[model samples]
Target: MKRRTFRAEVAHVNRPLGEALAAELGVPLEEAARLVDVGAVYVAGRRSRDARTRLSAGQVVTVVLEEGGQSPLAAAPGPAPTLRILHEDEDVIAVDKPAGMTAQPTEGRVGDSLADRVGEHLKRTAGLVHRLDRETSGVTVFGKTPEATTALAEEFREGRARKRYLAAVGPVALPPQGTIDLPLSKDPSRPGRWRATRAANGIPAFTEYRVLHAGKDFCLVELLPQTGRTHQLRAHLTALGAPILGDKRYAGAAQAGGIPAPRCLLHAQALELGHPRTGAPVRFEAPVPEDLARFFAAAGIQAPSGPIRPLEPPA
Candidate 1:
């Protein structure tokens, strides 16, 4: 496909790249943001993927578009999705985020994120404290106010909040319960992917796993991540020879226990943290969605009845 490129100079200071591109291209903000996300936006001759990148005055910006294709400006928006509210208050809100939904806006897509749905439901902007992978379904939280956003964000950054994930994986050879302390780094050869590495410069990643149920060909494991690194759990599990089922990026099996995998068999089952406004402990849980529940039933493995406790001391 032939590509078209547009270039312009930034005339204002501290302007977002998307806004600048929108004005230059005479397109909507979301369309411009999509261009930036797909690596079609450049600042000072350097490719920038973040739409929110702030530009200084006099800096040059460029945008490239494919010729003879559906222009981003002309793309139709999808219907707004709904979120299952698990908990809500003046300061915070928690919801059951379904699979196939991103926590926030992503490349080549606009709206339809958990954050966007939460904002629509609340009729105001909701601040996402953390995010889940697009295919992982379960409990997710958002801050309703700036103060709560800061406090909750601090809790996650400091590893004060507890996160629990339930995943179905192929047969495992490791111990029933243990910690994976492998460090992680971006896989340079594979753009937008991560891998477990032993290099000295690798960022530390840790996860504790306990086998909740072991079937003939599959095992249900509960994962507690001690650190919040991108793709940490998926990478660590793949390194341990038991990648999450249906996680094609991590070399997980396509089927488990004769059941064809639909999507990554991972779920953010629960989350616990102190109330941002009151310091009182608060917890949220999301019930297992239909796909996962069907997998468990067909595999003859019983899901955990309650929140699985950590095998080691909390971080």
Candidate 2:
């Protein structure tokens, strides 16, 4: 990663740190403010807070942006026919993602990704319109061109796109289901991690869960989130006292006698949106992955029924 730093003075005693930094760096205030926003700025060798805080003269501030580039794994050729195409067209394509494959490449995770495999299969570069968790596998859609990518992104930005997930939670007793309304925010102590809290400072998020079947130690669930945020579903389920099995990072450890989960028991069951070019509604679905299916079978849980429910906005 590339790193850059700018040194600036605190001209006035009451000037906000971000405003002063932006003025000194000759960049937009918002762009300069992101240093503090992402916790990258330090004043006098200590972490600075609140872009609006007053500043003192001669106070040195450091702004840094770690360089980001394609992961090395992205360079390795994808395994032949690794991607399973579920739906394809001139403008858009959807694939059934396998567990452990990232939707896109990240630092140190280059070779094994949906983009690499999909690009190899279609003989065209695939652009990710959105993302799914690395451990949560299932259907993911992509745009074949820059224009298509932009249109698909706009659909998600305008809240016209819908996504649903399927998960297995151990010892299911959650009300055949109910909505989990919680606000989530990044954990202050851990970067790139999120937590659910009743605190009002976080973004609004909601997930509706319905129990499909209950077994002796596990339950199949259909999950619908009204808004997407980092780790919203996992955190919400954890808060509900029925965290998805095999979710070690969030749920601690896999329970004994519970279907032995190897990954987070979450899948992108379906996606519904409009064609970027044609403006026609489109929907895609992916079946439960073998891991989850095998877990259910071993636990003696019945097959989950019903296509995922689509929640409509209040009329």
Best by lDDT: 1
Poorest 10 consecutive residues by lDDT, candidate 2:
67-76
Give TM per candidate: 0.76, 0.69
* Top candidate when judged by TM-score against the true structure: 1
Tens-place lDDT digits, model 2, residues 188-273:
77666677889748888888877777777677788888787889998888877778888876763475354467888888888888
For all candidates in order, the CA lDDT equals 0.79, 0.73
In angstroms, give how far residue 132 of model 2 lies from its true place: 0.8
Question: What clash count does candidate 2 reach?
Answer: 5
Candidate 1 structure quality by residue, lDDT tens digits, 44-72 = 76667788888876776655565237653
